[model samples]
Target: MITIQDIRNAQENIQDTINATPILQSGQLSQLCRNQVFFKCEHLQKTGSFKIRGATNKVKQVVMEGAKLVTAASSGNHGQAVSFIAQQLGVPATIVVPTDVNPCKMNAIDAYDGNIVKCGTTSAERIPRAIEIAAEQNGLFIPPYDDPYIMAGQGTTGLEILEQVQDVDAVIVPIGGGGLISGILTAIKETNPNIKVYGVEPETANDTFLSFQNGRITSITPTSTIADGLRATQPGDMTFPVMQKYLDDLVLVTDEEIRRAFSVVMERMKQIIEPSSAVTVAALMNKKLPLEGKKVVTVISGGNVDLARISELMIGTERIY
Candidate 1:
C-alpha cells in the first residue's frame, strides 16, 4: 500500500525530528559469520526506538488533518513513540496498554505525558478499545503496524542503511507486527532488488513465520519470550502482502539464543541492546544462513529493557568465554 516515494516523503517529513541513527560495524560478528556485519542502531533513535519515525509521520498527518487527539494500542515502544511525538506536537495521546505491559515502556509513556489506560492483555482486546476511545472522543486512532503511513515512515530506516553501508548484500530485521520488516523490504528491494531482506523472530513468538508457512495470517497464543517487543501474535494484514512479494526468508531463535546474543552485545560490543534487538544477532551467532563473504546489516529494533529485570535476563545464560 506504500510506495518508495511515500517512504522518501516520510524521510523528508521526519528528518527534522528523527535521528538518522548510526550504522556501526560489528567486528566480532564479522568474524563469527565470516562476513562484514554492521548494525543499524535504531535503539538510539528518538524515544529509544525506530517507532518514532512512523509515529512522528502519522501524528503529523493527523494534526494537519485537524485531529484534536490520538489513541493507540501498544505493549510499550510504540506507545512511547506516539506519546512522545504527540507531546512534541502539542497534541494529546491516549495509550491503551495490555494488562501485561512492560513497566519500562509504561514509565516512558507516562514520562511523555500520555493518557494511560489498561485494557485486556491482547491486541484483539486493546485495539478495539483504542478505536472505541477514538470514536468516543472524536479523535483519530493510530495503528501500530497495519497502516500505510506508518510503513512509509519506517521504510526511511532502510533508506538510511543503504546510504550508510556500501554494497550490502543482505539485511536481517526483527519482526513483531511486520511493519518494520515490511518497510525495510520495500526500501531495499525497490532500491536494489539483489539485496536480500530476511526477518528473525523469537521461536515462542513466531506468528509471522507461521503466516509465511501457512500462506495466510495465523494467530498464536501470547508468548513469554524475553524479547517482549517481538511478541506479536500475528503478522499485519497490510504487511503480509509486502513480505510475500519481497522478503527473502524468515528465521526463529530460542530465548536462550536471544540471551546469548544479548549478553554478547553487552559484554563485547559494550552496547546494552534489549532482547528483541538481539534476535538478528542471534540468527547470525546461530549461523542460520550462509554468509561466508557477504556484507550484512542487522537492524537493532529497540533498547527499552526494564533495568529491574536484568538479573532475570542473565539467569539462564552464561557470560561469553
Candidate 2:
C-alpha cells in the first residue's frame, strides 16, 4: 500500500512536467448544492486531463532507469497523457487504443508522435494486448490505473485540494478503475481523516459501489454511458483496497443526470467539461449524499470531448441563451 510519502514523492517527480491546475468556484453551483463548492479544474491540465500526472510520474522514473520505450492501453485520455509525456522525454510510445477510439484523441496522440496500434474495443481486450506489445518490444508498460506510481501520482490532486481549499469539509470524485478516488482517499485520510471523500460512478459503471456492497472486489460489464471515463468493468486490486479502507461512501448517477450536469456546466459555468467530469457535478446537483452546508470540492477530471458532440450532450437541458 502507498503512503502519503509516496504521493509526496510523486508530486516532486511530476512537478516539473505536470501542471498544478487551478481551483475555481462557481457561485451558481455553490448556491445549488448549498455548500461552499469549489471545482478542481484538472480539465485544464496538460493533455486536457489529470492522467498526465500519473503518466509523467511513471514515465519519468522509468526513463531514468534507462527505459527507451513506453506502452499503454487506453480508450483516449490515458493514451494522450502517455504520448505527450513520452514525446517530451524523447522516448518512443506505443499506445494500443480501442478500434473505435475518439478521433480527436487519436489526433492528439499523433501530434505527440505516439505509435498508434488499433486493438479490440473495451479495456478487457486491449489491456492484455498492450502488455504483450510492451513485452515484445522490450518497452515499459505504463498502466492506466492499477499501478502504485500511478495512484501515488493521482493522489497529488488531493494534496493540491488540501492546500487550495480553505475549509474543505468533503470531496466528491468520479471513480472508474478507482485510481483517482483511491489516491485521493489515501491523501485525505492519512492527513485529515475527518474530511469525507465520496466516490461517484455512473449507474452503468457502478463496479466500485458494488464492490463496497459485497465486501470485496467485484466485476460488472458496464453498460454504455456518456461518462466514458467511468466505464471500467471492475476496480483494480491495488486501488479497490484503498477505496475500501478510506472512502466514506460511494454514489451512483444516471447518464441523464450526467447530460444535465454537462449542460449546466457548459451554459452557466461556461466550462466545457467532458461528461466524465460532469459525473461529479451530477452527483452533487442531484444530492446523491448529504453534504448540505459543507465546504466541498469536486474534481473535474477532464475536458477532452469532440466539439461536434457538444450540442448532442446538451440535449434535454434548458439553456439561458
- Which 10-residue window in model 1 sums to the lowest lDDT? 312-321
Against the true structure, what is each candidate's TM-score? 0.97, 0.97
What's the lDDT for residue 298 in model 1? 92
Candidate models: Cα lDDT each: 0.90, 0.89
What is the C-alpha RMSD, rounded to one decimal, of candidate 1?
1.3
Tell me the tens digit of each residue's lDDT in model 1 across 1-321. Answer: 788999999999999999999988767768876788899999999899999999999999999999999999998899999999999999999999988888989999999999999997777778899999999999999999999989999999999999999999999999999889889999889999999899999999999899999999999986778888877788999999999999899999999888888887876687877899999998988889766688999999899989898767763334443
Candidate 2 lDDT, tens digit per residue, 46-124?
9999999989989998999999899999988999999999999999999998887778888899999999999876777
- Model 2's alpha-carbon lDDT is 0.89
